[model samples]
Target: MTTHFWLNETRPARQAGAPENRVYVRQYGNGRAILLAVHGFGRSGARMERLGLQLGDQFTTLAPDLPYHGKTEWYDDRYTPREFSRILQQLLDRYPDRPVFLMGHSLGGRYLSSCLAGLEHPDLRDLVLVAPDGAGGRYTNWIDTLPSMLVRPLARISERPRSILRLSGWLSKRGIINRYSAEYLKSNLNDRPFRRRIAGTLRSVLKFPPRAEAFERALQRHAMVCTVFVGDRDPLLHHDRLQSIYGPLPSVALHHYSGSHWLPERLLGEYYRNSLLTTVP
Candidate 1:
């Protein structure tokens, strides 16, 4: 593995969930506050390393791969946004005193949305959600592609019917439905190996439909300093609803960029675009 591919531990030391699981982490900076970087569907922890590294100069960064993503082990359990939120709450509990700042991209952004909607963590200070899902219920509503329509029903079936989950996995791996599903996120992930890891994880998230009621409860409970950023041209989210969601955040801010949903990767390393990531008021 390359230096970037290998995980680095500095603060609490690194740990993995299981033997087959790949939960590599890289930490940066001297600040006491923690920014938990979460990547979108199909993406691993490594993709957010640059953001961690960039923001680490000012704050302590903890970026980890979600289960069944990146280097993590795959399981039969339905990994919804609520479950991911619980995992994050646990992370906050593990680290005390330091204010937790959550940053997520794409599906990771969607998880942040659910967390923000339902989070009750008193320690959570702020949230930076990039291209978040469920804002206008974009990911839930998007049907431009046939895969989007098929994936939701497939996810719903995976819960009770054991045989379907297997079939879902089979179709996902065979490249019939998988390639079509990833057309939107290809630009952000340049590496072929990285792309496969991301695509596979996304397949898992797609199979498990989000629980809207639970997500709304979480939204009402948590009130943190939040900011939602979206690409102006991104077709997934409805612009009108995005505007509606922006009006009520008590401690929240909204930012619009010229890029697509994969703004982080597309804008990474470029000084101008990088500036925008930190250009919040």
Candidate 2:
């Protein structure tokens, strides 16, 4: 995997004297068709490297670390889906000549949907969404709302090492949070700067949840071949809701797998293979 950075001047400025927005991208393969894969929240582009590698033979897979995630510099007051989508649009512009395929998981899917909704790109040929969030709604549960409400205040306590350690330990012991989630949270707590940025991003997501109508509009207008894969047991998204949201669009096809939110490697690879062979002209 090779890392590259591009400075985006089109992104709206949130603060004075903020450095130019720099997008971090990981590239795989050297094929003519381009696959722009977007990772989910709390995850980096590295997570999608395997998917990229699997599809690399036929397509140049590019996974970008969205703002405030991975190496991408955070410039916005809050990381809104619209802003993330804009950044993706800018990234896609770099490869104007290549046939582009958009693939996103979870939050990335929401941003991808938002970005595709407003833009008309001739190079964009296909879209692949894996257990995406925001299909049903962004603020459908307290899990999303409570944290957003407390993000600012929690950032203060998150900066205190002892406070975070104690809270994490308590939450883990009571099974209020899974061990992996707890550890991830603890790591964020120790990193004060990252914590602040994450808090702001959370607040922004809560304030501006993805609109289903927007996604429907994008799907209708673009008329690109779209493949949507959702795990039957995905806790983050419901299959019925996804079907409801995407069923009406003739260009979109939805598939359901027997698994959880995370798609198994074998199944994912198979889908990618089918998508690459069938969609590429």
Candidate 3:
């Protein structure tokens, strides 16, 4: 059995100074630092808890539910990437001496950038993202482009069950998810709590303003070693756009693999140690 620690939402965002985000953290290894893992949209921190186990020999790991997602069961009326960044900062303030390795997937990657901006920690050394989001046009083929730009908007306006079913239908037809391993695909629906959280998260993004200023600020003041990983077959985001946003960083390196968007699940341990953990100095 794996040992786990639950961090309640008692951090500052809440009126009582309680953590606004609920975290499920598992400790591993003997290292002095921690890896803060954030999952992409429709996913919960619990899904990524294995990262801590995989890297436990080298560092402690904290996989936390983002606002409006998972155990947090909460949402900021005016949510933005900066809100997530500030929240992470509050959590890190408690462990300043230990180097923090920030790892995020997809949307989580976009928010992770905010968390790292303008922060100067001696031990804070590496930033890694897998199919990390931010750069536009990441998924460029006609099939992906049309849906991302058109269908996605329509789906947002569509009724819940109808939208989800429609989206599911579209996914089925495109065979976009065919490459994902059966095991990974199975896990997508295993966590009941996560399924509920996805509703609010999607709603927040559709309504919340995109804080481009905050994103730019973080990207520009970036002082950490950054590495990016994306699969060749992942639709919805293109590599060129991703590089356009993050490629400017002299310390950042981009790697491409022959996998899909869900590569993190199919190659969990491999991804943890390679694409993510490798950047940690």
Select the stronger candidate by lDDT from 1 and 2: 2
Q: Please state the error at residue 23 of candidate 3 in Å.
A: 4.7
Task: Tell me the spans in candidate 1 whose CA falls farther than 4 Å from its real position.
Answer: 1-26, 117-122, 136-140, 143-223, 248-251, 265-281
RMSD of each: 8.4, 4.1, 6.4
**Model 1: how far is 86 from its true place, Å?**
3.4
Best by TM-score: 2
Report the C-alpha lDDT of model 2 over 1-281, residue by residue, as the tens digit.
45556646476565777677777888887777888888877788888777777766777788888777888776655665566667777767788887888888887776677677765567778788887776753223223435655655554565566776787688669865456656667666667666755555555556445565666667667767678887777665656776787777667788888987664657867876776677666
From the highest lDDT down, the ranking of the candidates is 2, 3, 1
Question: Which ranges of candidate 3 are over 4 A from the true structure?
Answer: 1-30, 75-78, 118-120, 136-159, 163-199, 206-222, 263-281
Instruction: Give the per-residue lDDT digits (tens) of candidate 3, residues 164-217.
Output: 555655655676433332223245534544444444444444332224455555
lDDT tens digits, residue span 52-164, model 1 = 56655555666667665666543433355555555566566657776667787767776666556545556666567677765553554443234766655654443333444
Score every model by TM-score.
0.60, 0.77, 0.65
Give the C-alpha lDDT of model 3.
0.57
- Work out how many backbone clashes candidate 1 has: 10
The residue pairs in collision within model 1 are 22-71, 22-72, 40-107, 40-108, 42-198, 117-218, 117-219, 118-218, 118-219, 155-207
lDDT of 3 at 250: 61
